[model samples]
Target: MATPPALVFSDLDGTLLDHHSYGHAPAAPALAALRARGIPLILASSKTAAEIAVLHAELGLGTAPAIVENGAGLWQPGEGSSQDASDYRRIRAALQALPAALRRPFTGFGDLGEKGIAIATGLPPEAARAAARRQHSEPGLWTGDDAGLLAFAAALAPQGITARRGGRFLTLSLGGTKAQMMAQVARRYGAPLTVALGDAPNDAEMIEAADLGVIVRNDHGTPLPPLDGEASGRVLRTALPGPAGWNAAILDFLKQLDRRGGARTDG
Candidate 1:
């Protein structure tokens, strides 16, 4: 692939979409600008491939891929529904193998079913079904105490499974992060100047890894702490929240690139 001027990686919830409404209408302008410049926009989210594919097509991202399952997997464009549930099965099997005391507290999506997921996430029945279609990670509510949680993770570690707490759920994965997947995707695009936008602790690594990082305002979640890049102005925080903030940050950065004569035109 020829080197593009830039590539953008963005978190969906609380970043590119309204935290409550889950709409990106406010970001239409910036989305258009990116399209006009032929810049690839990769949606990075904990959403499953089934879930992300709908939005990927809705956003008209063409062949750009997405970082899905909280970076546990990638969703390439044009791919049909994934038949490979091997990783998901492995993770579930690992959980079942744990002691009942360690296992009973974690109520995973497999245990929740579609109706339970819909109630848990406020997604509609169909959307919850999509969310439940896990391929590489399992997210669940951890009812165990902190010590038990620690023990749970420790036991799984030997099996190559890792646990991360994000929002209301404890997510288990075989081990991959948004930053790692971001680098892999950037390399596919010829490593163009990268910009990453996100609004949570899970996004910190990817934000720090990019050429420019944007911390989109998120009133619904805990604010990200000041990052090292902020001191050098390589990272910026948006004044507004959600997609509106995403729009302003992206447009401003594009302007800066334009002024520096660095914004590459589409060939």
Candidate 2:
């Protein structure tokens, strides 16, 4: 069978985009390189659909489907979502139903209005509003004294929800993970040699699920914890930090792929 183009699932913040500035300029060369080769770069991020929608346009990714709200929803090209998406209201309701003590510590976006979100996220007021447009998960700074967060997690567990800790906050989603969504995306492309890039614990599953795993160095000046299969040759970690590291690693991976003549192999 003719080999399909390699599918790339990339996390935005701290990976493809700068952790602080939220710019992907350093990765421009790599992005262009992939574009030239017709590689599909699917942005899978914790950002909301509104946020990713603007970014998709900025990146010139006309109508390509993007995984939004940390895989709790999918955004296809065109007017709006082509598929059924998750309901943030349900997540909020569940949180509201939790015990006051268990819920008080989790300062989620639901509690932070646009202004507070803007201040906390370092985003502009409008951008913060878009971020608050949650469809699946709720993200916020986990400010809890003692074991409150642990109790919160336990409370959420039985509700079919989980908290994914990122650089700044813990995101709560209902049985949704980037890895699961990426695998669903793979089915669309005949499962071409999957490569995933990420920089934090939230990305562990997606990183592990990839045929080629890329651990992009974060701004913290450290790499993430060991993924389940990093000992093998399929995983790579960048030497630099931020998008500079992201660019270099992607270029290297592409060159390696080119060495195989653009053919997807089972190896």
Candidate 1's displacement at residue 167, Å, is 4.1
User: Per-residue lDDT for 1-267 in model 1, tens only?
Assistant: 767788999999889988877899999999998888888999998889999999999999999999998888888988776878898999999999999988988999999999999888788888999999998899888888889989999999998888876544678887589899999999888855999999887788999999999999878765788999999999999999999999999999889878987666655
| Candidate achieving the largest lDDT | 1
Q: Candidate 2 versus the native: TM-score?
A: 0.91
CA lDDT, every model vs. true structure: 0.89, 0.81
- The C-alpha TM-scores of every prediction are 0.91, 0.91
lDDT of 2 by residue, 1-267 (tens): 233568888998889888889898999998888777777788998998889888999998754578887888777878664333355777888899998878887888989889889988889988998898776788988878547877888888887888887766789987568998898888876746888998988888898899998988876623479776778867788887778988998888889888988833331
Clashes of 2: 0
Off by more than 4 A, model 2: 1-3, 79-86, 145-147, 221-223, 263-267
How large is the C-alpha RMSD of every model relative to the true structure? 2.1, 3.5
Question: What would you estimate as the lDDT of candidate 2?
Answer: 0.81
